[model samples]
Target: MSTYAIGDIQGCYEPFRRLLDKIHFDPVKDTLWIAGDLVNRGPGSLEVMRFLFSIRDSVIAVLGNHDLHLLGVAYANRKPGKQDTLTDILLADDREELLTWLRHLKIMHSDAKLGYAMTHAGIPPQWSLTEAAGYARELEAALRSDQFPVFLKDMYGNQPDCWHESLSGTDRLRIITNYFTRMRFCRADGTLDLITKDSANEAPEGFIPWFAHPHRKTVNDQILFGHWAALEGKTDTPQVYALDTGCVWGGQLTAMRLEDKQIFSCGCDDV
Candidate 1:
């Protein structure tokens, strides 16, 4: 019995499956915690989604930006771009089933037993693990609720700058979604800066990576995330693992065995 925490699949179904086979993952005895990006930007988005959908009960995933974008694009009646791989999914015979199952994924998963909090992107500096979980529930409820379309309708942007208690409507939804899905760098006071998506050297004058915030209280809990592919699978700390690895952008797909933190990765030959 094992629990495997995999990095962003990003629609790379072959690598995703090979990595699972390498670990000999058993749905009944072993569980999975995915960092998300289950679809988009890779060749097999539809197959990857269908495969995961078949085992939703055995898998736990935190929705990534690409995952949410797939939902929004589907609902908003948008078209997939040249680099987008979601057309395979949107045009699938079971598109409705796939999208519905995806919407059911939460944005965060934290286990005190495992001593880790897993999210698609890093959690905000202002949030403790407990608070992050609670806030995740708030958005998860909305995402799972009938009002989800309304929330998703206005879910994007960096407004409501800091966490404002009185934030309302789409503004509130955007703030919560951005923090959980798009957050990377923020100021010491915890205001998110979503515009700059670059390396540590270009972090502007005051912004810092979410993990580097001086007052962050989650240092005790290992934070596992999978955005910022430029990190090249480096979290810069043993306790923190950044697993994006650019699998969708022509890099290796990585997975970690949680009990002993043993890494299993497969190289990518095609983009």
Candidate 2:
């Protein structure tokens, strides 16, 4: 038996499957931990969702920004932009089941025994792994409860771009969601630089990559994360894994065997 951590699929199902084949994945024995962005911007989101749902018990995934966008659009009637390609999923016969399952997916996942943790994006500098887990549960509780629709409506924003113990209501959930899904660069005090999406070298004058913050609380744990394809899986940090290799942008789909950290990839060829 083996475990593999996969990068953002972004709906590039063919390359995702090919990467799995490259790794010779066997559902019966090999489990998967996905860094999220399983849908949108590619041609096969519906297929990806269906397949993942089929093997739900063998897979663990955090929700990516795109994944949340899909939910917002689906349940909260949030409008879609031009680049959005989630119509197939929205129109699928199993859309309800798929979206429901997606809504319940975690924003952070960890295994002490495996000595690794996973999130769609990096944790905030202010949060230790323990705090991250608690925040994730709070967001998940709101998402899984009857108030989910209201939460989804409030979930879209870049407000309160910093963390504080005093944050409450939608403000708290929004900040928590941003840290787990949309974050990349931030200040030492955990203030997110939401407007900057460039590579680490180009981070704003007073900002640094979240994982590079001097006082980041998760330094002792290995972190697996996606959502910053601009890095192309490079952080120059041994314990930090940036798995989004831009498969939907014609890059490659990547997977790493957990036990040995060996990588497997398949070209997307822009779908």
Highest lDDT: give the candidate number.
2
TM-score per candidate, chains pooled: 0.94, 0.98
Off by over 4 Å in 1: none
lDDT by residue for model 1 over 1-271, one digit each (tens)?
Answer: 8888888888888888888888899998899889989888888889888888888888999999889888878886545567887877778889988888899888899887878889988888777888889878888888888877767767866687788767776777788888888887888656888888787557877888888776786766798998878778775654788878888778888888889989888777632
Clashing pairs in 2: none
Clashes counted in candidate 1 amount to: 0
Task: Give the Cα lDDT of each candidate.
Answer: 0.82, 0.91
lDDT of 2 by residue, 133-246 (tens): 999999999989997999999998889989999999999999999999999999878898898989989999899999997678888789999999999999987699999998
lDDT score at residue 148, model 1, on the 0-100 scale: 76
> Distance from true position, residue 35, model 1, in Å?
0.5
Question: What are the RMSD figures for all models against the true structure?
Answer: 1.9, 1.1
